[model samples]
Target: MSAWHRPSSRRDLFRFAASAAACAALPGLARANQRPEAFTSGEIVENGHRFFGSISRGLAEGLEQANKKWGRPNAYILGQEAGGAFVGGLRYGEGKMFTRNAGQKPVFWQGPSIGLDAGADGDRTMMLVYNLPDVEAIYRRYAGVNGSAYLVGGLGFTALNNEEVVVMPVRAGLGARLGLALSYLKFTPDSTWNPF
Candidate 1:
């Protein structure tokens, strides 16, 4: 062989393959860091119906109606929560947060409430998040208003707002529910029993 020519070996092939793989992954990594664009109401409605089945019809309609006022959401969370209340209430849930341009991230949320509330209810919830600048923006305590009636069919919905981000929680479940309460949800990176 000449000085400028060398036979390619298995080691060289492996190195080339590894380099190509890393290069291909760079775009995905970069995209993961970027904020996602707003998603359509139809997309969220479809997902809700698919996940919750027959009961989701009311929730979908509620979201569609709210979409007229809130516009499209930048992200959404699909999760289930079960909790009971006797004056003071506590709830916990886990789900995946989907962004339009970026991928999904696992999320856990827990919260406490106090007011004229009493119930033992378990519900599947789809939360539409609006004006979210980034995924990390969701990791905060969102304050809930006392008497924002967002109900449809057998399902009920509530709107929780904290400045620019608006979270509309659509729920389908059972139990004697009444009155309103001051509540807040804390979205954490991991599941925790602590509600504070």
Candidate 2:
């Protein structure tokens, strides 16, 4: 082959293998750096938690009538699911992440979703539940259910043009107060009947 298009040699293959091995170990290294009891022992480290709490209170107050009408608010829950950066879309990535593990229960709650999008990179979303009734229902179901459940990600607080999910944009900066950006959504009873 010409110098412009030469076939890779065995030395090149070895170098490629070494790089691949190192790259593959990165995720393992990241996990190893994490203390096993970080969540149990530490206070809220991510700003996302503050927003979640505030939104929960708002939903409880704003959607009171809807909560009473439903009589059983089982879909919205106030809990945290450890999420990592994903490929494809957020929903698909979240579903894949949940399905990968065994004995995981699903919770369905919609409030405000905050996400960041850097150029050419996939977005990471943080969702907050405004309705306490919905939050309680999700919590109870997760606690009682033994098997895994499917999780749908990102029910934006505001529906886009009355169709798409509403997304509250979060700017990327160093500790620039984010919890204040929580958006309120009007609670509407889901028409589909869920067995759970």
Candidate 3:
């Protein structure tokens, strides 16, 4: 009806097409960028029992706290690790990353800590994975803090992150270890003694 209401020129038509294309693509882009569906509390609790052999008070506490703070997880790592901290220390663990979209792959992680910390023992570790876009994305450095140890020794609520991916490790009845440390965990495809 009017010049402003209709495509008046070739340039205007091209711009309109571009806008339409972008709008059409928005949904796919959103789907592509969306992280996988997270694990529910019921699922986590069941898996937690299976992973740790039994659900303890420490495990329950950590899981509840983590779930409340970060929602849920789309992937997870079940493994064992050992380290002792006396002022500074290193931790190493190997496990398999399980994801509905990416299947499962072996993963190894090592981390170093520094603070007024002390203790040592090896324990089974279950890391609840969140914001993981893919399996390969898990292989990166995630910095975290063991700021507190709950219910004696079940440490599971520590948040390790690399801006994009977050791994919340939940360990229960692992050992007689305790301390507070700022740490960075580097995950790799293979095992290495290096903790840097």
Which residue pairs come into collision in candidate 3? Answer: 156-170
lDDT of 2 by residue, 1-196 (tens): 6545333998887887887799999986664333222111012113333544333443333234332432322112123222221121111112110111122234432232223311121223332222222111222211110111122322222211112122122211111111212122222233212223
- Candidate 3: segments with Cα more than 4 A from true spot: 1-35, 148-156
TM-score of 2: 0.21
Error of 1 at 185 (Å): 0.6
Q: Rank by lDDT, descending? A: 1, 3, 2
- TM-scores of the models, in the order given: 0.80, 0.21, 0.75
lDDT of 3 at 175: 53
Q: What lDDT does candidate 2 reach at residue 11?
A: 87
The TM-score of candidate 1 is 0.80
Pairs of colliding residues, candidate 2: 59-130, 74-137, 76-134, 76-135, 77-135, 158-166
- lDDT for model 2, please: 0.27
Worst 10 residues of 1 by lDDT: 145-154
Compose the digit string of candidate 1's lDDT tens values, residues 104-174: 88889888888877766777878889888778888888889533222222477778888988888877765
State in Å the error of residue 176, model 3. 2.9
Q: What is the lDDT of residue 123 in candidate 2?
A: 26
* Residue 139 accuracy (lDDT) in model 3: 82
